[model samples]
Target: MSSKIYSVITGTGIYLPKKKVKNEAFLDFKFFESNGKPVERPNEYIVDKFQEITTIQERRYVADDLVASDIGFFAAKKAIEDAAIDPETLDYIIVAHNFGDVKFGSNRSDMVPALAARVKHKLKIKNPDCVAYDVPFGCPGWLQGMIQADYFIKSGDAKKVLVIGAETISRVIDLHDRDSMIYADGAGATILEGKESSSPVGILTHKTRSDTYRYAEMLTMGCSYNVTEKNKNDLYLKMNGRRLYQYALETVPLSIKACLDKAGKDIMQVNKVLIHQANGKMDDAIIERLYKLYEIDEVPKGVMPMIISWIGNSSVATVPTLLDLILKGSVENQEIKPGDLVVFASVGAGMNINAAVYQF
Candidate 1:
């Protein structure tokens, strides 16, 4: 094959909030079931059980004054700086976030200008051709934005693109719901440059699937589960945890295998798997199943780097954040060097799932 343009990640950054909400912080929380029945178990046991299953010890919450766009700008600035490129040279700013800038102490989401425009304004980029937009594909949103960036690069329509995954889920959670603790606020960004090479490099292959017909409601926004709450108008993020878990277990491995297959790469050749930090146990199961699909008996150690223990699930922000950390050598025992093959995968709200194969 002749030389071709590929979307290669040139720079990356992440913004994790300073407000560290530890598992103990929720001990005093009055958790309630969807049926309005209060969880009667002692909070100590509940916290321990949660920790055992999710492996989340603490998660970050953005400061009261900040929202999704603010943190996204923070990460975008770092990525632009890291790439050592002029801001005006950028071609696109794609922000993937579910709740659009939900302000602190307010349940309403402000989406008039779009998060990407707000980020662009903060960046002060003068390029009118630098198209900006928002993507809301659930947790897979960030990876999907990256897939779109790849297309722009390959089509020769753009030279550089900024893909950001940012979320302020804390502002939209029902405090009384136990699942509320699973959410955190964070942002991550990457600058992808179109590089022409004779051999395959940068993004290799990708696949995405949306099971909306039957699984659209797997995750949604709903009124507070607390029956005592009078604000029926304010809805928070809701999920069918059991069904979602099972759904991911059955699908994520297949998605990964499919993407790797498209890349003509074997599972054993992958150096790392950057998966969405949703549930620790579920991630383990998904990886295990992926190995089973290859007829392998053991998953390589350190193949998947996990941050959910401390960072929690920031929805679309998870995979990109994880990638940034690994690249920066911040993730313990996890590092990616040149010529390494890695997989980025995520599953979330739209009952959506996606995976991308990248070679550094």
Candidate 2:
């Protein structure tokens, strides 16, 4: 009989930029009507609306000279230290991002120099055998990278992998668009180690699905759906909030339930449900729906922890950053213990959705 080799998440780290921008900061920003005419809403009214929808009161922004990979490297360093693993001992370095190395305050990105490679160089890892790569799987990128690391461990292709999700998404948001209120900037990371275990623990089950066929146009960049010409060349992100909210409320819960079912567990066994910190209200509604699927009437507090109120959605970086904060006790009264069941889930840009069941 062969012993099971489990991929365990040994450590986690996150990096938030120094600058914080309050919701009130957007008061002077103009909002346009469908006809391109400026809306007449008061500044306080707009700020309150944003708070009601996203539950986000502020978000961080990177310095104008910094890039996504720079923050990623910082998070990775802390994760490696937390794991007590030598950087040169890592077998693979996987970076998950959407805009690549997006320079703060600019739409331009330097993709030729891959973000993973940049992180490796910044870490001063000397081993040529420590292969590095990137995964651009929308906002679910970090969770997906963790899934891929599990695969490598199971296949005996790698013993240790470093996975990071980082982004300067604020650089991609259209300041004139309301969607900008939901986007921010940050980075997070984890180290996965392969170890032989007697029990069935670590990453148990995971599933990913995309609805690009029907919803590809629901969220996108480089122009609005019906408008063109000057806006055609615009490179900022634009989303149909109504469609996105509807899709998330319907799809994300099913994905979580399906993933837990595959692991031979029920919702009652879950200790924590760490979802992508997208919108405060939308996330709350999704969790409420999840409880209903199991026929539970009420959604308990502290079961799902939220950081979006202080740090808006940084795309791929959301999950890991939230996890790290909770684990470190930075978020009061929330913690993950050994042998606890933790379910991770997220949905975003590709119209891609994913969930995973893990034993911590």
lDDT over C-alpha atoms for residue 214 of model 1 = 85
lDDT of 2 by residue, 1-360 (tens): 567998999989999999999998998887665455666787689889889989999999998888999999999999999999999999999999988887654586678788999999999999999999999888999999999999999999999999999999888777777678888999999999998988887898999999998888767775433355755565877788899999999999999999998999999899999999999999999999999999998887689999999988998999999999988989889999988999999999889999999998
Pairs of residues clashing in candidate 1: none
Give lDDT per model, in order. 0.94, 0.90
Cα shift from native, residue 276, model 1 (Å): 0.5
Give the distance in Å from residue 59's predicted Cα in candidate 2 to where it truly belongs. Answer: 0.5
Q: Tell me each candidate's TM-score.
A: 0.99, 0.96
RMSD of model 1 against the true structure: 0.9
Candidate 2: misplaced stretches above 4 Å?
A: 224-232
Candidate 2 to truth, TM: 0.96
